[model samples]
Target: MTWKTLIVRVTDSCDGTCYGCLWRKNRISGFTLPVTTINDIVSKMKDFSFDESVILCPNPLYNPKISDIILSLKKVARKIYFFIPVNSLSKVRNKRIMESIDELVIVTTTPEDFKVNEENLKIILSQGFTNIALYVAIGSHTINMDNILSLVNMGKEYGLRIRVGEIPYSTALTLDIKSILAKKGYSVGFTYGMLYGYMASMAFIGNYPVTILAKPLTGECRKLFIDPYGRVSKCPLQTSYLRVDKVTSDILRSLIFSECSIGCRRFELIPKIEISLLTPDGKEIPSEVLSLLEVISHVNSLRAACSIMGFSPSTCVEKIRKVEKEVGIKLLISKKGGKEKGATVLTDEARRILEMYREIRDMVSESLYSEKGIMRFKLG
Candidate 1:
């Protein structure tokens, strides 16, 4: 399935001031972009096929031009989701803004913002605005359970959907806690699939809340966040760091699928290595070459093997020659000198050994993922 696309308005020229803001530390100077870039982005999105799209302006209030920028996006996007912090929610004219498109995703970083969020929600609801969602950022350093409960209760009372998200670069919540919270009726929005390695959990506490989980949707390509400055990022939280220009929707789609495919392919190739030598009758091969097996396990290529074995190219060739002499079979030296230059290929014997090793590796990996009571997850 095609993944959703997000056009992020990241050109806000913040003066490097906000506390707890990750971007404050790595702020780049002279990074402003022309307004025409937004037009280019809109043109690209129109050509880019996707299931849905969102306009992510982290602090839209800080930039008055955001409304104009979003107005341009409304022309290209059928449904646009907005995520604005609670502090800036009040400054927004709900009536004029809600008419632009589909959903308003209000984000709250602290419990104090809950009251303000509630007040804003009521105003929006009273105005007959229905497509509204709340995003709560649960920080590891200063998150208060009392505040979380209050926000959840408030969301429940108002019949508004709540999505709980963890702070950037945090993995504090355990799966058990996530499962328990999910059972208790809170919608968790994890940033697990973010570009960086940080993992987060998402649980649904209500019937209609948005749930963002770690895994990508089946049959669908993964989503990517493209910043206003023409930088294509994999996630909103990673917008500052992951900047890839000269990006199209197709390249973004490939990037996501390639990541998943590479992981699966690696696992599949593991069974092709020889775990142990076997007799001619297919009996267990002796463990005499176990040290070599260990060495091979760490070797990704001939160069790597040579490095690990503390052998130069010439030494490696001599070692292979010695092994062939002892085993009475031709040993495959991965490197070959040819007119096309040096090339690497596994000999038939080497291939057999590699295949056996891979089989054993696959067995071990399968055992781990399929361990008793391990929970497989799906996200919407």
Candidate 2:
């Protein structure tokens, strides 16, 4: 299945360093991904439709060729997000970078950072970007939630969505303020990995179900996370990643059993079918008949369905006739305006055939992944 979201690592350079770095620990060297690798990712993602946004991770503002990389995916991606950092004196020198970015997520180390970067945050929001988020990274120092409460409100006044990440706040304090803060626009992100047990997840961040959903542990292995060295990791938390050059079906299937999410079965499984029908006389029923039937099944109007698939009314009817002649059965029932402007439906025989084909197509995946596994997940 094609992924709706793609997170590509553009650079490892950051203007400011935070204390509570979960991903960037021990990573000091500044690095940029090769242009060829970037092009390869852009080329591969041409099939998927990214409605959420293409997340350029670590940092993209430091990259000199950020615009060139973004331009390559502009055709396929609807929006581009950058983890652009902001400090007290935050100012983006490149206007193009600021303008091109659809989402600007400023992750803060301490609660005080929210107020400290208020002016810089304004500069970022003024660039016509509506999706501004402030993430709190809990460090060694304990922060008074009172100040954070006010800062979060201030951000909300300017329409900024705030996120608090991985901080072990008092369960009592989070319980006391969870609903109060949520009403004013607050999202707490909790971590659930081998490092931190699930008990911790259910305690502090359990008040918000979104915290569990946001965690990378619920991965589908759909994202291709490429590091500066062209190493590919499905989950951002993974340390053992495959090289970009050696990517193949065998390699991808192997990841279905990765160490992360050893027992969790949250991977999404979507089935798609493309089948051809044959008559006893050896007459072939073309693919366009099923393609048109599939479209008409969802949409009520035959004319609208034809328009959506770039098929003219006459051509669609002609194809339907040809298929009917080969199959020796009427496959569609047409009607005048009903709930929709016009209507069409697959006949009883057509429904039986479609169900049989879909069941067989689903068996293909089961046969492939039933034996192979990524832990408890079947990956045969």
Candidate with best lDDT: 2
Candidate 2 lDDT over residue span 143-226, tens digit each: 446645554566556745455443321121112233233333333212221111111111112121212112223443344356
Ten contiguous residues with the weakest lDDT in model 1: 264-273
Quote the lDDT for 328 in model 1.
65
Q: After superposition, how far is residue 86 of candidate 1 from its true place, in Å?
A: 0.7
What alpha-carbon RMSD in Å does predicted model 1 have with respect to the real structure?
Answer: 20.8
Q: Which numbered prediction scores highest in TM-score against the true structure?
A: 1
- For model 1 the local lDDT of residue 182 reads 38
Q: What TM value does model 1 have?
A: 0.52
Model 1: per-residue Cα lDDT over 73-161, one tens digit each:
66655456676666655666746667775667666656666674567567778888766666555544454556666777676677555
Candidate 1: segments with Cα more than 4 A from true spot: 13-34, 116-118, 141-145, 168-177, 182-221, 237-380
